[model samples]
Target: MLNYWIGMAAICAFAMAGVLAAGRRGMDIIALLFMGVITAVGGGTLRDLLLGVPVFWMIDFNYVWVASAASLAAFALARHLRDETVWAAILYLDAFGIALFGVQSIDKALAHGFAAPVAIVMATITGIGGGLIRDVLAQRENLLSSREIYATTIITGGMLYTFLLAQGGASHGASLCGVAFTFAFRGLAIHFGWQMPKWLTLRH
Candidate 1:
């Protein structure tokens, strides 16, 4: 299914990012690969449980293999590509993966007869859940803790996808738009250092 492939691609992208990020901390290759697999499967596993479907990886072993292979590849190549600039590459890839997963989650939720609002929320969760897990496990600050407009971008894209579906657009078409909008918003945010308005920032 389209959703499956989208999820798989996102998994690979995030896994690679996780490997690269962990490598920066001087993690061993095996540990880096383990983190990568976790990053890849964490979100979808959560999504499936929340949606009351069979955990995807349990049914399809190929997803596991793909994530594992991606992680290993990233680790093997880490030394060659390791640099301060790798952070930017990770960010961009993470954004793209998030976008894809967000749209797919929204579409999947809708197909399961969830209400639009709930679908949008689930989409946002799917987009960021894995990365949050990765950050926590890696002992890095969670992206959600920042004032950066990460989840906001996912929500915006989900809303757009939901709206288009309500307006009679095909599921695939709406998902495409959702992925595009999310990638564009996050990419712009990174390039321009965008953040939530100061008025909306919570003081510690």
Candidate 2:
């Protein structure tokens, strides 16, 4: 139940971020909404498939409705938000969404009795999967190809959450902290132009 609500919130945040991000490119309302929905559910859908659970949207139509509604709302309000710093807003929202999904994914996996390592990997995927799909569909370079500190932040947050769980911390509070930490790290990276060490980056 907790995971469900967190997932919905993450979907809404990313959907709004998608519209804001694409709107800055002068995309039409329809295009913006399409991108939003993809950004909202791409990650969780993948996570469910991998876990062999019923696709969430299949069992719960509410996820679809919420994602679609958020997308439309973003589209309708895009012009009003046009003057806002779209990129920065999207980055921050993306960071939050990533953190939320990462923690939820790990918690869900552990609930299902998965091994810790697998849970960590699933959490990482849940963090980045939606954004990857959003970028690809929008014809932009995925974050994985950039020098950004995206995946690193996700991994760090997931590890932190897993450690807390192993230490018998309350799952909800630890997850919240993990999400905050990931968002802070990612937001700071964007603000400070932080990048992975050159040796760790691809030489191209």
Candidate 3:
């Protein structure tokens, strides 16, 4: 039950983040809403398809309603927000959404009896797939090329949660720990402008 609610909140966060991140000149409300809905569910949809399971939103229409409502709310509020504020909110909301979704997806994968490595992979997808799609759709610079420690945070945090489970840790405790670590790591990386080492990037 708690995980369900957490999933919903993550959806809302991602929806709002998508709306703000993709906002641009001459974009209509329909386009923004589409971006929001896609960003909110894209990751999980991919994960489900890969896992051979039913898509979550299809199972419960409430997810779509929540995402739509959140997207519209963000759209309405966006005009009042400065670009700086919007970007700041996008950073935090994206971090929070990824953190929660990463651990939650890990739990789901494990429940489906996937191997730990596979679970980790699923978690990574669930964490960043939505944002990646949104960026691609918006034709913006994405995490794939950026130096920010984004996907790394999700992968590392998912690994931590899996490690705790292997060590007999409680699911709730491990989840909280994973989410906290990911959010803090990503948040700090954003604030401090952490970048990948030069060697890690392609040379010009």
Best candidate (score: TM-score): 3
RMSD of 1: 2.4
Q: Model 1: residues >4 Å from true position, as ranges? A: 1-7, 24-26, 84-87
Between candidates 2 and 3, the lDDT winner: 3
Q: Arrange candidates by lDDT, highest first: which order?
A: 3, 1, 2
> Tens-digit lDDT track for model 3 on 124-157?
8987788789999999987788887889999999
| Model 1 TM-score (2 dp) | 0.87
Screening candidate 3 with a backbone cut-off below 3 angstroms (N, C-alpha, C), the clashing residue pairs are: none
Mark the regions of model 3 whose C-alpha exceeds 4 Å error after superposition. 83-90
lDDT (Cα, tens digit) per residue for candidate 1, span 4-118: 6766776777888877765566577777877898888887788889999888789988888999998998887776656657767767877988898788777778789999898
Candidate 2 least-lDDT 10 residues: 79-88
- The CA lDDT of each predicted structure is 0.82, 0.79, 0.87
lDDT of 1 at 69: 91
Most lDDT-accurate candidate: 3
lDDT of 2: 0.79
